[model samples]
Target: MNANHMNDIRKYLKYSILNNCNFVGHERERNQIFDLIQRTIRCGESNSALLIGPRGSGKTTLVNDVLTGFHKNKSFVSDAILVKLHGLIHTDDRLALKSATSQMNLDNAVDGKVFGSFAENLAFLLACLRTGEKHTSKSVVIILEEFDLFCAHHNQTLLYNLFDISQSAQAPICILGITCRLDVIELLEKRVKSRFSHRQFFLFPCEEDSKESPLDHTIKRIECYLSLPENSRLKINGAVRKQWNTILKALLEDKKFRSTIQRLVDVDLNERTLRNILVCFFDQL
Candidate 1:
């Protein structure tokens, strides 16, 4: 209402926007997963890593983080290509090749008929981003989320070929494959299994880890909200803050609200029903 009060709200809003943060509950696990990917890229090991986790366990988020993080690193001069094969599920070979070529440079210089031509197309795309002059550098990581879908729907030959490309790629193509099903390897052939063995990283659910509690997570979120610049309009007085915390505790403790909470927490809940629920609960307080 007052000038000083108005100034405080504006600053808080600005801070929240600048951060654009996702307060993932499993921060420690997320960090561990990030470290493993970093080590793999640095080591230049010749193999594809599979990220196996439940659908909502942040597997895809981790993959995107690794890809975007490394690409923006100062040491990384070349481009990193992340192709979601799911998008190309029904695409023909020509369309697949076109997607690959568009993703990278498939000049006549590189053999077009190489093993797993589509995979090679991806390699060629990375190759084009090369400086041509030789120098030691981190290999270009090709992240394919839901890679197992390709194996199940299409032939397993593409994966086998990608494994081979990882071993012999000129630009050093490292495939980071993600899948929801932990038993994906059982569907793959022995050769594919052998190639993907060492690089595999399994992402566990929050319930599996003792260190990360839902309350701890909610507290962290509260901290993030509190840390917003004073000008931000998020008003959480002692009473409202306590009410918000209680709502979060209930949401996390109840499995039924897990999905709903995940969706609601990402944005401000201005819906009439949610607003009414909050009002009724606050009146009771």
Candidate 2:
């Protein structure tokens, strides 16, 4: 390659690493999330959605990515609240309720007279928001990840309460509930089950050989490794580079090889493992 061309490629690689917001695949899911956000905001009404997926399946990341994109868009100005309830340490039900409600500092208080029913608390909070009164603004979209905990430990009181309150809300508020467990819906009360069913969109995992190829993911991971400022080059000889390409080609073409590489590298693998794989692939090539 010419000197200028090589330099340009290097510069593009560096910029890609720095920005790091490029989503290589998952176009369908990404588009679905984006469409949901846009429609909900434009309607200026209350909506709730359940995002279902297994752990490490990019459930939370997908939400964050969409929100990040929304924030970057010049025309999209909306109050998007993302809250995660994982390992919330609460001594009792009161403490748990307090911890849950306190995350937003919603100006509304749970009606003390109603004895803090999930329904009452949500009703009070929505009543206090005066949502549309804030001028021509996109209302709030609250994304709650790891929602199964509430279902597992508490009854469906809170879930149903939120559903009922959302119906009467003056300000447009939507709940984007994300959970890994498939049976999370079963835990909800029958009333909630019906309500959530009406509005929810289910997302399944991306298959290994689907448009989102595992080999491409591996290459992207390798690129990330190469871009790190570790002050230690991979020391890839000409043979090694050729070998790396061969292995990558094979991995892309063969699902078995990709699975083997995944088991070897693991999710929390380091640069050394990556280098070792490149060396081995080179020898094989």
Candidate 3:
């Protein structure tokens, strides 16, 4: 392969492997979230949900996919205000509450002035949402990333208030908390937990082995990547692409390659590790 071919191969591998593969698991969870958002956006229903998964397991990806589709509908964009809060950025309830005013463009409601106490500010926002005024009555959708960190705050007030609102009939709010912590529920205070709807979606990366051949999805991802369309932007020579794909097929039947893949699957072939493995494959080329 020449320099151009090698570069194209690298780019194609990284893009296809890292970002292109659709979520091969969690079909139910994805659909549930999509429906939850649709109800909140269209019906003004209040809901609270938690998406629990280990880091890099695509909890964020799942939410983004659902939201991106909904964003195309004018009702979704106009009827709801989306506020994203990360535990790392808004370390406390006060910061979160302050940031939310800005996120909802209600800063103008405060006229850029330093607002009242954080609790007061939260109360004010809640009042605005329930005020029955056309502009202020938009539904609120709050997504908390790294949700466990927010639980570490002194009183867990942000979670409490959001949960309280989620159960309300007057103001429609949808709250989704994404976290890696399995015991996240235990971290919540009893009062806060009481208000939560207890709607939890759990996602775990697929275990790729039953002590068998490289699992179907495992090989399928490689097949999809290798069998790029003739007119793909990668511009890889068709004959060379066919040759590489042929090699992949032959390797699937080869004992040594199958054994190697099984060992990798035993240890979990996550996306990050898969990228490194591709780099190692490049070194051989």
Best-fitting candidate, measured by TM-score? 3
TM-score of 3: 0.77
Over the stretch 1-285, how does candidate 1's per-residue lDDT look in tens digits?
455544544455345433433435555556765665565456645446777777655576556655566667765544334445542452444454455554454545455456455665555555555654664334555566566666654556567766766666454556667787778778888877666645567776445555755444443444444343334457645554455446556655676655554565455332223334443543453
User: Would you list the clashing residue pairs of candidate 3?
Assistant: none
Q: What shift in Å separates residue 36 of candidate 3 from its native position after superposition? A: 1.2
Q: Estimate each model's TM-score.
A: 0.60, 0.61, 0.77
Give all candidates' CA lDDT scores. 0.55, 0.58, 0.77
Candidate 3: where is the Cα deviation over 4 Å?
1-6, 12-21, 112-117, 126-136, 207-214, 221-258, 279-285
Best by lDDT: 3
Residue-level lDDT of model 3, residues 1-285, one tens digit each, is 567776787677667655653454567788998888778877878999899988867788778878877788888877788999999999988788779988988776766556555556676776665545653467888899999999999888788878876776557788999999999999999999999999999887763433324355566545655555666677777887777667778876788876787787788876456656775776576
Off by over 4 Å in 1: 1-33, 36-43, 77-84, 87-96, 105-130, 134-138, 169-171, 218-285
Q: Measure candidate 2: CA RMSD.
A: 8.4
RMSD of each: 8.1, 8.4, 4.1
lDDT of 3 at 161: 74
Ranking by lDDT: 3, 2, 1
Candidate 2, residues 201-261: lDDT per residue as tens digits? 5555445546654545656665553332323233334554455456545555677866776
Model 2 steric clash pairs: 119-161, 243-282
Q: Give candidate 1's total backbone clashes.
A: 13
